[model samples]
Target: MKFSKTLINWYSINKRDLPWRKTTNPYYIWLSEIILQQTQVKQGLPYYDAFTAKYPTVFDLANANESAVLKLWQGLGYYSRARNLHATAKHIAFDLGGKFPNTYKDLLKLKGVGDYTASAIASICFNEVTAVVDGNVYRVLSRYFGISTAINSTPGAKEFKQLAQKLIDTKQPAEFNQAIMEFGATQCKPKNPDCDTCPFNSSCIALSKNTISELPVKIKAAKAKKKHFNFLVFISEDEKTIIEQRQGKGIWQNLYQFPLIETEKATNFKSFKSLIKDHELLTNQDFELLLYNKEAVVHKLSHQHLYTHFWIIKVDKLPINGINIENVRDFPVPILIGDFIERFNF
Candidate 1:
């Protein structure tokens, strides 16, 4: 199709010279794809450098400790991705003898490697003629062809993939795939797109009919439920803060954070004090709420919005039960708590 030629021509001159795009190294390609998920280019660039610099090979990453890996991925949300990356690296290094999977099916067998990621690595690194249909390709294809099916729907995703496959240049799959992705990201943005400069503007169904913004129909995501948390930053007599490693199945599982007390609703001052008074953890200690940290940050996840109230409490001595205080900083904590510590010198 002419779409492939047009896109490759444009990409040869306009595509961003990203570091990951400079080589066909499977490990670097895999790292780029994982980091780019749910993250913008500007945000993921530094992380890409840090990860590649620290662990130059699959073996290096495979042998790294989980805590060390999570610490590197602290600020980046979606801790599961980091864990999966570590696991996948270990599998490749130990099980496969440090050689990364060379095909799409092999890549898909690894943890956290979904269809999109598999296609990306297969085509970009190995020149496999697999279509890479990401958010950009979805938007560009749906709008250009005026497909109104919800992008997240099963049939909708399949239809888009077929259309993308038709446009992929079999001879130069890597350049052609990247070209379309770049075109969608730069010109056919979700907001006011630069249709005047877009090469497909004349033929684009959305641009011709003046419906650019609404062409890529998508199912609206469910509303996030509110969760109120009262985090007590208990500073011990020896200046250690109480921390615990989260275990079992739940949000933030396998991560570390300060001791938490969740409530059905937001607690007022009186109720908060009363709840602390009745709680067994603080009932026997000489704990006193010293100052209320005014800067309460709302951390939003895909399905939950956590409204955290940080209370700086002073305890004459640390609690001996239900909490671990020794070498708390050795374990990796959540980024929210890290930000709190940075702000208040905790």
Candidate 2:
């Protein structure tokens, strides 16, 4: 049997009953794809259901507050995807009359929609004959073909994408696309796939050549930058706390966080005092230190590792900018801050 037919036959019997696979709805497909970008299906599914339940349509998502969207997206890291998803929803709802672009080429124009995403949306929703190439696809192809090219490199991407495009079953583009991706995700997994019963086991290049473990070569990613964060969890006599929206193009852009003091080194009580006084942060007598979090929140982002310590501060009066504890959840905040909020004593 040919590659596409063999894969499709296996998929028909083995495909997991995922929520997103049950529909041709572009919005749901787009949402699932975005949420699953840096996350696994298990982690992204609940988020997918939550978003769809909260915002049933593109117009609903577009009309909803950005803060609300981010809050719902709290723990699913890669906050930029949430922001972009909101932006694209608005574009589709308002600018494009709530219609998702039907072609892969047009879908690529929306914010955060990349080639693979556009292809998946286009082919799956509109039956456009396009191929999708993601990490799973990369793994499956490189191993089956015994290709040695680094999957992250440009030449490798082009080569694999072309091969995938050639093999797409144009008659049932959606089914074909989903089958291959599902096959890759389940059968040709990153590690220890059950090759003994795999349909392609006999013809799989990596298995035949005894190089399954080493076929899908990938270069090591650049080291993540480490930074120290001391967050002032300021509370007033009324129990109100302080938070500010992250501005500019930083990691948690548009998300709310505490008054942050990023330092060249991890800070202790003495170091905190020096940082505050030297920076002329607060009036000496107005604020008092109540306590510090017994443990620091060590949050790992894609390219940055943040060692964060939350310092509890008691102030005579609320900062003109602070919000009531009751209203703090309304604002969008990074998951790191959300975790701190969930654990801190009011």
Error of 1 at 102 (Å): 0.8
Query: TM-score per candidate, in order?
Result: 0.94, 0.96
Off by over 4 Å in 1: 294-296, 321-331
Look at candidate 1 and tell me the lDDT of residue 187: 77
Cα lDDT for residue 140, candidate 2: 87
Candidate-wise lDDT, in order: 0.84, 0.86
Candidate 2 lDDT tens digits, 36-85:
99688999989999999999999999998888898899888888898899
lDDT of predicted model 1: 0.84
Error of 1 at 312 (Å): 2.3
